[model samples]
Structure formats: C-alpha cells, structure tokens
Target: MSALLRKIMNFGPAFFAIGYTIGTGSVTSMIVAGSTYGMQLLWVLFLSCLFSGALIYAYGNFAIVTGQTALYSFKKHLRFGKPIALMIIVGVTFGQWNSLIGILGISSNIIFEMISLYVPSAAEHKYEIVLAIAVVIIGTMYSILLIGKYSLFEKILVMFVSCMGISFVLSLLVVHPMPAEVAAGFIPKIPEIAGGKMMVAAFVGTTMAAATFLSRPLFIQGKGWTMKNRAQQRKDAIVAAVLVFVISGSVMAVAHGALYHEGKRITHVLDMVNALEPIAGKAALTVFFFGTLAAGLSSVFPCMLIAPLLIEDYRSGQLDTNSKQFRIITGFAALLALAIPIFGFNPVKGQILTQVFNVFVLPLVIVGILFIINNRKLMKDYAAGKTLNIILGFALLFAIAISVNGVIALAGQF
Candidate 1:
C-alpha cells in the first residue's frame, strides 16, 4: 500500500469512534442545546469533546500498553475488577440499547418523512412505514457486519462519517450564522436559565460518554495496534475529537441560526428539518436530512456491535465479526429496539436517559482505567505518568459533577 493508503488505514479505530460519537443522539442533543439556548452552550460541547479526547487517549493508551481491551484489563487487574467489569457491561449495554432504539426510530422517521414530502399519503400510515424502513435499515446493517471484515467495515463507517461531516458544514454555511455570536458562544458561562443545567449535563453525557471510552480498547485491539504505535493512536484520537467538534458544532450552528428565536419547537428530527425549511431554504433542509440520516446510520452500526464485541472482550476470545453468533446477537438487539417505534416512548427523555446512564457509570470505568494504567507491574515502564493522572483526575471530577447534577435534575422532574 502507498503511504497515504497506509496512513488512512491506521486511522480506522478513530473513524469508528467518530462514527459512534457523532450519531443521532449527538445531533439531537446539539439541536436541543442550540435551539433552546442559541449557542450559549457551545462551550459545553467544546469542553466535553476536549475532555473526551483526553479520556480517549487515556483509554487507548491503556489498551496499547497492556495489549488488553478495557473490560478484560479491568477484570484481570483490580481487586474488585470482575464485578466492576460486569457492572460496566450492564450499564453500557442498557444505556446503548435504549439509545439504539431511539436512533432507529429517528432514522426511520427522517427517511419516511422525506418520502412523505413527495408522497403525502405515506404519512397517513406512519407506523407501518416506519417498521418497513426499520427492517431495511437493520437488515442492511447486519449484512454489512456479516460480510465485511474489520477493515472493510471501518472503511464503510469512515465514508458515512465524512459524508455527514461535509453535509452539516455545508448546511451551516448556508445559514450564514453571525461570526460574533458564534465567537461569543465559545466564552464559557453557566446556563442559569431553565433547562440550561440539564442541557449542559446532556451535552457532557452525550459528548464525553462512557461508552466512547469503553469501546475504544476494542477498536484499538481490532486495529492490531500496540505500544509501538502509540503516536499513531494519539493521532487517531485527535482526529476523532476534531471530527466530533466539526460535525456536532455544525449541527449546533445550523440549529442556532435557523431555529433559535424563531418561536418554533424542535421536538424531533423531522420538526427540526421542517423548521429549517423557511430559514435555510429547501436545499439546505435536504442536505441536513441526509446528514442526519448518515449520522444515525453510522452510529447504529457501532451501537449494535458494542454488546457482542464486549462479550468477546470479557471472555478473552475472538469471535469472528461475521459469525452467525455475532450477527444473531447484533440482530437480536435491533429486534428489541423495534418496540420503541411501535410502542411509543418520548425520544427526548430517552436521549437524556442514555447520556445520563453513560455519565453515571463513567466513574467505574475511569477508576478501573486509572488503577490498571498506574500499575507498574501490569503496565511495566508504561505506567501512567503524573501528568496523565492529573488529566484523568479532572475527567473523573467532571463526570461526578455531571452525574450528580443529572440525578438531581431527574429527581426534580419526578
């Protein structure tokens, strides 16, 4: 392979991370924040992504140095590692499965809504149409994973991620948001307004999710990366973080420009799409929907893969990504999620719960990572230095604060 091809191939894990991070939940959360607060929470997105990158690096380093995925590392190293690993598995699986259901619902809704734009009658039987769309999507995802090896799968995800990123940026440009307002959004300030704190916590949970950290080790292992490729791993983390910022930031910009101060509510993906029509024109709306669809699909691919892959990690066994067992496990998750669209649940609440669960369970992973990474016996000379610990410490504190606030918010709601 040429140097360029080789360089691109090395970044597969990062692309997977990007595909997973910038999915429907990120888009929805960004829209929620931007439409409600008019970019006042851009600082939250910025800080969350920044901190997430650091945490990703920290997690990736753990995998590289030890040559073990995160769950396996946790199980082998800490005194309570086994129970902690099981807890993480339960937490991540529950949270992601919930979000995955919502993601499928959102994607089907967007595709069907677009179809309904031309064929109005289709909207009349929305439920059946959504199920049909869901079947096609879920089936397609299963076939891809069943047929392709890791490299090919990574390439497909990278392509969609690129498409989503470009489409969002182009749509943001069409809206022509004010530079001063965009600049002002970067100055950190607490959201004192109603829904402000919840938005901050949501952004943090979505952007800096525990699943992102837990899943990285699997990707790193899949890429055949080791300590010898440490620099490359760090580069990939930076790329993933940058992609998260650009794609999610663009979504927020468009939301702020088109929906903010418009006396409109963005209750769903379709609502946001329709809201943008009067402001950014039909062309922009089309581009935004395509971006949203791509984002949703890209994320769905990994969300389905997480549980089965984690099972492999825990067992310390390699399951063929294309095996029937693997596909069955993945497809079962998709099947369960079909209930969300059929039996209705509030997507916004589902999204918030997804992020909160991730944030609430994050400290477990963080502590396990810190313990193993700092273990001189396990990490050898690769034990984490003081500087890395300080960074991880800050991340832990942020997770704790967000978790506390999220619990409080949810309690108040009750």
Candidate 2:
C-alpha cells in the first residue's frame, strides 16, 4: 500500500473503540431490547451511545494530553486509586471472561447456522460444529495477537467492522421498518416488563461499557497519539461514536420490525438467527449471521486483550505481545471462554452475570475518569471544562442509577 493508502487504512483509535463497543454485548442487549419492548426503549439506546461517545472523548482526550494511561493516572492522582484501578482490572477481566462464553457461543452458533443452510446434516452435530467454529475463531485471534502488531489487529478489526456494518444495514433495508415508528422510538418511555428495569440498565451499561473506557487510553497510546494529535483524535472519536450508533440502531431496527411485530420471542441468541428465516428469507438469515459473526470476532479480539492490557497498565510495562506473561494472561482468558462450549454453559445466565458486573463497574470507572479530568495538577490546562463536567455528571448519575437498578434486579433474583 502507498503512504496515502496506508494512512487511510490505519484508521484511528476510534476504530478500535467501535470494534470494542459494537460486539456481542451490544448485539445481545439490542436484540433483547428490540424484541421484548419493541422501540419503547430506543431513546435509551440513543442516549447510551451518545453518553458512551462523550465518555470516550473525555477518556481519550485525557490520555492524549497527559501521555499517561488511565490506570497510571488513577494510581498517581488519588490516594486509593491503585486499589480502584486493580479492582477495575479484575472486574473488567472477569466480566469479559463471562461475556466471552456468550460472545463465542453466539458467534459459533451463527457460523453453524450459516453452514447448515446448505448442509442439512450439519444440523445434527450442533455441538461439534459450535466447538469447531469457536476453536477456529479464538485460534485465529490468538495467532493475530501473537504474531501481529497493533497495526495488524487494527486493520483486521476495521475489516470486521465493515463487514458487520454492511451486512446489518443491508438486512435492515430488507426488513423495511416503518419510519414513523422508528422516529417515535426516540420518544422516551420505560417498559413495564418483568426484567424491564434491568434490561434498560443492561442497555445503558452494555453501550457505555466499563471495559471500553478502560481500554481507550491503551489503544490511543498504542497508536502514538499524543497532545499533537488532539484534533485528529476528536475527529476519530466522533466518527467512531457515529458508527456505534448506526450499527447498534440497525440491529435493533431489524429485530423490532421482524421479531416484535410478529409477536415472536428470543429464547436463545440463535433463535434470532432462525427467526430471520421467514421475515427476510434465507439470504438475509445468512447475512445477519455473517454480520453477527463479524461482531462476535471483533469483540472477542479486544475482550481477550483487556487482561493483558490491564496488567500492562498496572505494571506500567511496555507493549510486548510476545512476552510470556502477556501470553499466559491472554491464553487464560481464551481458554476459560472455550469452556462454554465444552460444558454447554447457559448463555442467558452468562449474559446476566456479565451485565451485573458491568453495571457494578460502570460508576467506578466514570468516577475514575472524572477524577483524572478534574485533577488540576494532573490535567493542568487540559482539565475538563464546565460543559464537559456537566456531560460527565449526567453520565455519572446515569451509571449510578443503572447500578442501583441492577442491584435491585439481582436482589429480586435472590
């Protein structure tokens, strides 16, 4: 590739952000929200992505200006920040591990479904097919991270995002949802279902994920973005936020139009895939699965990276994909996730666990960023201004509210 082409191909930090946020967590949350409540909660979806974007900017801008990763800043500034940062690492790592099962499970299921479209016999060996697909997907991710540089990972994720974006948008076109209903979905109204409150919290938590913010600084630093790249970082952040909104909204639109109107239910993630058979035909079913597969793989790659990156941040270590410690940590996460297929873990329970941990972690992370940005000594002239503080304040409140709701939901389960 030429220099110009390579520069364009490199994309930016936002691409990684998009790749991380638009994964299985976003997909599963959107699917549940759309299927169960129709578009009554679309307003929340919009807000989640918007708030997430703002937080990404706040976090990304901090890293760019200070030349420090988030965890390091936390450790340096606040007295108790080290423990909090460690907590974030453990919470995010464990949460993503639980999420890995569902992500990999859903991804493998879609691949199985796509193949089963032609090979009817493939239907009988569902477990084996899922295992094969999971192995291949995780194996490829391990190889990439092991042999490739951050640039290679970014390039591959860009392709994954593109594939998911195109497939989802095209599938939405086939669904041909009503414009007025979609518009009205923007009007805020809470659902009164069984898990309505938790679902709403899940929607918000999943979109504005804790791991995404925690991972931002490392990704930006990897790209060599410093204070000089602030303008480009802002531009990249905006574009990434928009892509997050579009991809997530497209999936919800397809689900609401196809599943909700038909009074269908989503008992399993794969159920959504099979449900697509009649609404948009086999071609769309294939398209949706491929899109889902792309989303899954995109997410799995970053989900695996979090543990190692967290360790890097905690130790203030250099990036070393070939390091023994890094490989062991990453490998542990990958292996743990693979157990989902081996034991046939419950996807719903895994999702609930992931969301609960996410809600619990969200507020702490927002506060960490808030503290970093508000620290005059640390941020100096780059400290968050009034307008930005107001945005973060709302986000902080939102996260707290969601966390509370999640707690109540968990308590009720007991």
Candidate 3:
C-alpha cells in the first residue's frame, strides 16, 4: 500500500474499536448514567475511558509485536494451564451472549420508538413487529460482514460516529449546561446518598462498560498490525480512545443539562431525544433519532462480528474466518440479536443488565490483559511500564468493587 493509503489503513482498527464502543448498549448506558446520576458519575466515565485505552494500547502493541491475538497469546505465553484458558473462554462467551441480547434489545427499542412517531396507532403493540425488523436488519449486517471487508464496515462506522457525535453535541449546545456544574462533573467526587453504598454501586455499574477494553487487541490483530508499526497502532488506539471519551462526554453533557437540570427522567433513548425536541425543535429530534439509529446499527455490525470471533477463538486456538464453527456462532449471535426485540423486554432494563455484565466481566479481562502484557516472555522490552501497571492494577480493583456493588444492587431490586 502507498504511504497515504497505509496511513488511512491505520485508522481502520480505531473505527472498529469505535463500533465496539458506540453500539446500542453504549448509547443507552450513557443515557442511563447521565439521567440517573447526572454528572455525578462523570469521573467514572473518564476513568473507564482512560484505563480501557491504556489496556487497549498495551494489548494492541502486544498483538502487533508478537503477531498474535490476545486470546492466542494468553494461551501460548501465560503460565496458566489449559483450565484457566477454558475458564476465560467460557466467561468471555457468556459475556458476549449477554451483550448480544442487550444490544438487540436496545436497538429494537430505538427502532420501535422511531417508527411509532409515524404510526401512532401501532405504538401499543408494535414491539413484535419491531423485533422482526431488528432480525432482518441484523441479517443484513451479517451479510455485509460475511464478505470479509473491513474498509466497508469501517467507513460506515465512521459515518455513524460522526452523525451521533454531531447530534449529541448539538443537543448539548441547545441545552447549554452551566459551565461551573460541567466543570465540577469532571472532578472526582462521589455522589451523596442516604447510605452512599448503593449510589456508589450504581455509579460503578453504569460506567463499567464505557467500552469493551478486552476486544481491542482482537480488533488490532484483525487489522494486521505488527510491532514494526507500533507507532501507528498507538496512534490508532489514541484516536479511538479520544473518540469514545468525547462522544460519551457529549451525551452526558446534553443529558445533564437538558434532562437532569429540568428534573426530567429518561428511561429510553427516545426519551433523551424527545427531551431535546421542545428546546431544539423537530429538526433536532430528527437528528437525535438519526444519530441514535446510526449508533445502534454500527454497534450491531461489530457485536455480530467480534462476539463470534471471541467465541470461535475460545473453542479452537485460532480464528479461521471460514470455519464452520465461526459461521455457526456468528449466525447464532445474529439470531439472538434479532430475538431480543421479539421478547418485548424493557430496553432500559436490558441495557442496565449489559452494563452490569460488563462490570462483572471487566475485572477478569483486565487482570488477564495486565498479566499477559506484563509477562516477561511475551512483552520482553515492551512489558508494561511500572506506571502503566500501577494504573491498570488500580483499575482492576475499581472494576471489581463496582462489579460486586452492581450485583448487590441488582439483587436488591429483585
């Protein structure tokens, strides 16, 4: 490839990473975090984004250097026996299953809300039809991936991210949050609650899945990055991290200003969009819907693709794009994505569950990545620096605390 083309290709993995983060679950999670806690949990978002980015960089660099995906590297280089690898595989697979369900559920809800605007008569019983539509859309996404072209998917994801970014930023502008309050949100402070414990748990759970840090290495590997191109990979990872932070922060700012300030509560993405309609007018509402739709669809593509790759890697030691197991797992995931809407589960609840699952899974994945990236045999000169290790170690601890608290909160709700 020419120099210019190669430079552009370096962006490929970042776009893929964005898709992993910006999906249906992500948008809904951000909305929940913003509406429920206002800017109180904004620090978690920053911490999650920074920590995840660091891990992504480490694992991406590892993959590029060693020419192996994170999972494969873990199996080959880690002292842990096959049992540990099996456990990781099983855990990751289950996590993906929950993620798929949640993504499908939220995406279906978005579609249902968007369509309900046109046909108010069907608003009450449209969920079944919405689920069917979601399935068809997921199938279309799968067909696009079956062709095995990253550029096409990357371009589409970039476009979606752009639209979503513009919509949320515009919404934030319309709402115009108090600069002081917004600034305060950036400060690390826990929210005040009667007991403080539940509030802390919700705060942690809500921000836990800021993005899928574990999947970044696999994405980087798929892009064919190598150690010789470590600089390029670092650039790509940085780009992705910044995008995630900006987009998520924009959503929170808009919600904090538009919804929380007005004492408005949002249980769905449409609620967030509808809240903007009065202030920003119908055009703004339309933009919000379009942005959200794009976010949902862009996420569907990666969830369908990467979840299956993780599953297949767990079963076999390699990612054979052509293998029957790979195709079957992808097909199954796509089907589940479609089925989520059909079941008529509350999208908000499903999104919360997804975040909670990520909270639980994140610590394990972080520990694994930290271990592998720091392994002398695997990283050699590139082993995680002391500062990075300390940061990651604290991040893992935070994730564990959040995961436990989230589970307790969920149990309380039940």
By TM-score, the better pick of 1 and 3 is: 1
- What TM-score would each prediction reach against the true structure? 0.94, 0.95, 0.89
lDDT of 2: 0.80
> Model 2 over residues 1-414: C-alpha lDDT tens digits?
588756655556777787778777678877877777888888887888778888889988998878788887788787798899898888888777777877887777777768888888988998988898888988878877787488888888877888999999998999856889889889977787888887877777677878888888888877887788888777777788788889989998888888988888776766886777877898888888788888988888888888888888877834566788888888887788787777777564466457666778888888999888988887889899998899889988988888888888777777
Task: Give candidate 1's whole-model lDDT.
Answer: 0.81
Scored by CA lDDT, what does every candidate get?
A: 0.81, 0.80, 0.67
In model 2, which runs have C-alpha deviations exceeding 4 angstroms?
1-10
Q: Could you tell me how far off, in angstroms, the CA of residue 9 lies in candidate 1 after the best superposition?
A: 3.2
How does candidate 3 score on lDDT? 0.67
- Cα lDDT tens digits for candidate 1, 228-270: 8999999989988888998899999888888787856577656
- What range of 10 consecutive residues in model 1 has the weakest lDDT sum? 344-353
Of 2 and 3, the candidate ranking higher by lDDT: 2
Q: Residues 90-153, candidate 3: write the lDDT tens digits.
A: 6555655666777777666667766776677777777667767777787787787676665577
